[model samples]
Target: MSSSGRPPARTRARVVRRMQRAVPALTKTTMARMQAEMDWFEELDAEQRSFVSMVLQAGYSQFIEWYDDARDRETARATPPLSAAVFGTAPQSLTGSITLQQTVQMIRLSIEVAESELAAVVDPDHAAGVQAEILRYGRELAFATADVYAHAAEMRGAWDARLEALVVDSIMRGEADENIRTRASALGWHGTGDVAVIVGPAPSDGSSPEAVVDQVRHAARAAGLEALGAVQGDRLAVVVGGVSDPDKAGAVLAPHFDHGPVVVGPLVDDLLRAHHSAAEAVAGLHAAAGWPTVADTVTSDDLLAERALDGDPAARRTLAETVCAPLNAAGPDLMLTLTSYLDQGGSIEATARVLFVHPNTVRYRLKRVMDVTGLAPADARQAFTLRVAVVLGRLASNQR
Candidate 1:
């Protein structure tokens, strides 16, 4: 034996020689087992297959080098069992194609092949040691692979969080430029669908913001929608796509937020107009406290009255344009009819008496108001909006 506790040089050569002869059969059997057992492995294209084969080849050769040191068992243990270069040689994109579980399956299959060939390679005395090392190396490699995947996932999550925040900030700032559009597309935004923004207080649940955003994305995906989101300062803003009704989208995400008003803006036709939705949702969030009877989730359109009362210029303008302008443009008769009906407790007879017209005439004008403005004066909530809109319109008209 050598002074270093290694076997004699001639003895060491015999052990390595037998293992080397077994390498070809081990490689063939491992590949065959993989082909039979792993459908994903067989389905890889030629280039990817070649890459996988090369990694396997490196793993085998690395094992032989590691096993050669087993005579000095402590030194073998100290030596890195797996080559760092082996895993690094494959393109990072390969991880995307081959899942960690599949990689583990491949590693375990290789080890099984190695154990089966052991008796043919080394004598029984050394064969036992080689088999034991094989199991140990397999466990180590599994952990190494887990570490690789975990690191990749962590890096990707951090990058996505930053990207999501960027997209959300641009929308909130109303910067729907081509640059922001490209970023949103990278974040899985479908440009062809209606889009809306929902905002609320960030959850104080103490989970990492990245985890919260991931949860939101997962939930949105399951609901057949695309979402981009992040917690910005104290507010959580999520832009949801592929939904027409803003209220339903808000409801889908409401449970993830803190206990407060979760507000959705009006749905816009596409992502480019998402900023309009974002502005309205943010304004509504600020004004939500004024309306105590609101549901946990509310729409920006639904909060227009409170928003206008809270001095949101957009809400005030929307009321004037969508409600009053249509009423005034339709004719003064609709305006006078809505005012008279509301003043007299929505009674058609009383309104007719006040307008000096037939009750049917009052009814006809009220129906016209509904058709022109989409607000039915008979409904208490809508009547309140109508009243606010008409008053704001008069103020705007007087200003003009």
Candidate 2:
């Protein structure tokens, strides 16, 4: 009625005094109701319970103090509720311990208790007006609770991403030490099963980086795998856990990448040795350009030839020891026949003529070479791999 938008000073002062007198009793009754009614509240440890009590006390005080000396509805709507002052002063960890829903229940119950406590203090004719304002005040408290929890959640998510990136970077950089192990455990990594690493271009489909990584996690979990991902510059590296089949895990995650070969490393027994897998994946990803038509999702083994040519000693050793050494051990006949076959453009007659043997003899020796090396020198890709292995094997032996 006044330009100050408040009730007459006498009435306003009387009502404010009555509300202030009821707060302590109201807060005590609310706490008692919460402990009896809320299982989560009763289950909190002593420190958290104390934090809750402090917040409850602050809530009631702030609710009373939050009111300007104004009685108009516009003034109540314009009031700043006790979001930060109530919850922010408590430990941030409390935000996680008490969920937003539970916080809502607390707000509702506190208001209910307040309504009853103040009912006897105010005149009966004005009780309805007092209760309406109290409920409006409680509603704003709920909004404040939501804002605090939402901010806590946002902060938590950011901290989680940074920790996850550290774990991935440590493994890729071959530094999976105790510190990284502890950090990965905090990220919920279970060290009980196979692990692998996948490297590819970070997806660029206009999705936020968080959304992309979240989808990768969702997809991996849906496939019964645990995945931790990080977008470092243009590349996305994911460390996958519980992988029974590394390629299957890769297939499940490949669609999340863009414009590059998605290379999966070999499966290792545990996270500690996952650096080996991560290393191979990084090397293969770098050498992927050498294979122009490589599949979208390829294993590091599939890129062995390119990696060997790209001067990865691990790939070179794998090729020479696994393919060339065995062929050489099967004796000179098998070695000579296979080399002549490759050098003479894979023609049986040409190879036999070069080795001075019958065509069937050349064929038989080629079969023996396949047995010794487990690589057929006939298929195009297999032939390329075999050729590189032979070259690398010779270079290695010549140096020796």
Candidate 3:
């Protein structure tokens, strides 16, 4: 009898038979084989066997039949009773039987299993109930995946914004003794230990920033280094410890980043020094090397002068003014004439033709300039110095 009350004899009998037939499949043995395998089965009395068989029939056979009918009804058309949990119907046949229709049906069943088990959870009772439950779960999962994907997207946006800022902070920190020492001491960076800073672009080409960070961390571990990374606005900063040699570190890191450029900063002794060195190196690489908006693997020693030269625009202006004062004071025509003259390998005739002036006028201006700047127009070294001075003078005066 069901909870509503009265024995459904036919349903009961079908359940009972189904359970008996399924027994061999479940146990992987015949009754005789089962008895041989287990001493308990061999010793069972007839009453015991009957009792066990009936119990099995109730749970397996009856339950399965109820499950199958419900499931079939769900498949055929919309129905209400099939939706209830207790009557969740299973398919009528085992999924892997032979026959064209059976094979087709089996494939569909496999899909259902995947959808139910891997993607969403479904009950095995009344088809109507389970189908309703499937819809509910599907809605819930769809909402969940959307929420997760949205959160991941937001994280990526914020990561890009913060990446550059963090890298700047880290590099700046390394240059300062106090910051480097503190951070290094905390991280256990020490003598003969190499520190390297890596700046890379966030994988905007469809790869997850979090996955990239994970890869970087993995690379750091493989290199036996302490590594830290931050993401800011399509940029990634990674600082590593354990290697004193910047070159080796770069080589080790090159293969890890499959996409995007990576610019390496200089290696330093202590944490503080490394921070500064890295910043300088990265800056120099960008400025002197004309590095791409994206770059990888740079060191301090490689770009010290260029980095230093970039320090203060005002200072550079001041220096240029001082160096080129003598050249700038000369008349514009004279300056142009002298430049042409020098460029023409000090040939008076060539200088005159280019400037549309007489050779003697060019010679006269050259003499005056030599007297003023003490630069020998004939000497290559002096000529280079003069050219630089002239260029600097023009720059300082904003004469363009």
Candidate 4:
């Protein structure tokens, strides 16, 4: 009976027919809208699907007020491959993948189907409430997709770490497979020629060790070398192979930024030896000159080891300062004049021509330098000493 105390038989039958007609229309409309969405779902690779599924399910449960933790425990029984795991594998065919956009549309269509059936059970005005619920559910699904993407990012990171460990283990054990080799090759590692290891210091702002290792690997590749990168705490270690020129390699390697300091170990003949040398070289930095901090040349640190072992960074600093102070204080004009004079075999006339100054001005500056730094232009030993001093001074200043 209607609220007006009239029989509702006719009205009910009419409502039922209206709902019956609406169902097919809604289905057609929804199917058309959702067809593209399903195609989108099928477009996801396996890794993407795994991430998206988790996120979508989270939203589903939240909207329906279901206990997701319990549901997750049940779903986890069937292991979903992590997104990071498959990056090393053959790229999946879109044989079975789904996108977030499609998943949302599917859920929305399902809600519309539910609402169409509900409309027949109530007044025409009650159908408006069902529509509102469908809209709300659609919003939840959209947000769920975003959550899934973020989670997938974290999963990819963890997967990469695991893959890196496996790759390093294979190379170190000398049992690397064709696939590993292929991956390495794609990354520009060729497994030929001598390999050098580079260990860089920690950055003051806590630079990412993994990023540094990858950078070194990239540098080696760009130079047509084979390489691998690893992180040990704040330190970065790169094992390089297939490089023909060590000096040239260093030049190729220089642009990579590091935190504390970078140290290059002696080159090794094979991957295993390269790994050992790199690890030792990185450790040597602590026992070398600067300990916790240093730069590109491990040789300098090795030279200062005994003094550094006695905890005398100040001595090394003072020695460097004493050698380079004169050239630094002399300014660019004197330094250029000195360089030109050295190039001219210490000829004042040649230096004057190079500097576009009077020969007397060159002579005057030379005299002033000798007066200030006790270095005579005529003494070969003093000149050599000054040259090394100047080089060391510039390096030390750069460290600051």
What lDDT score belongs to each candidate, Candidate 1 first?
Answer: 0.83, 0.84, 0.51, 0.54
Supply the TM-score for candidate 2: 0.90
Q: Write down the worst ten-residue block by lDDT for model 4.
A: 86-95
TM-score of each: 0.77, 0.90, 0.34, 0.42
lDDT of 1 by residue, 6-61 (tens): 45768768988888877777777788788888888878998888778777776776
Instruction: Give a tens-digit lDDT track for model 4, residues 1-400.
Output: 5573322556545544554445444545554554455666555555775554444333332322221122333565522222322221222222124444554566666566545654544576545543554465456445644555556656756666566655665544446456666655554456787777655654445556566666676676677776676665555555667766655665566556453445566667765555545544544555555344434554322424333334455334544555346656767766677767877988999889989999999998888767766777657645654554455566667889
Q: How much is the lDDT of residue 360 in candidate 2?
A: 93
Off by over 4 Å in 4: 1-123, 169-196, 207-228, 239-400
Q: Is candidate 2 or candidate 4 better by lDDT?
A: 2
Could you tally the backbone clashes for each prediction? 0, 0, 43, 10
* Model 1: colliding residue pairs: none
- CA error at residue 153 for candidate 4, angstroms: 1.5
lDDT computed for candidate 1:
0.83
Answer with 1 or 3, whichever has the higher lDDT.
1
Tens digits of per-residue lDDT for model 2, 141-222: 8788888988899999999988999899899999898887789889887776899999999988887777888999999999
Tens digit per residue, CA lDDT, model 3, 23-133 = 434323233344554454555566655443343223233333443344354567533321222112322121112223422332233224323332222213323343443
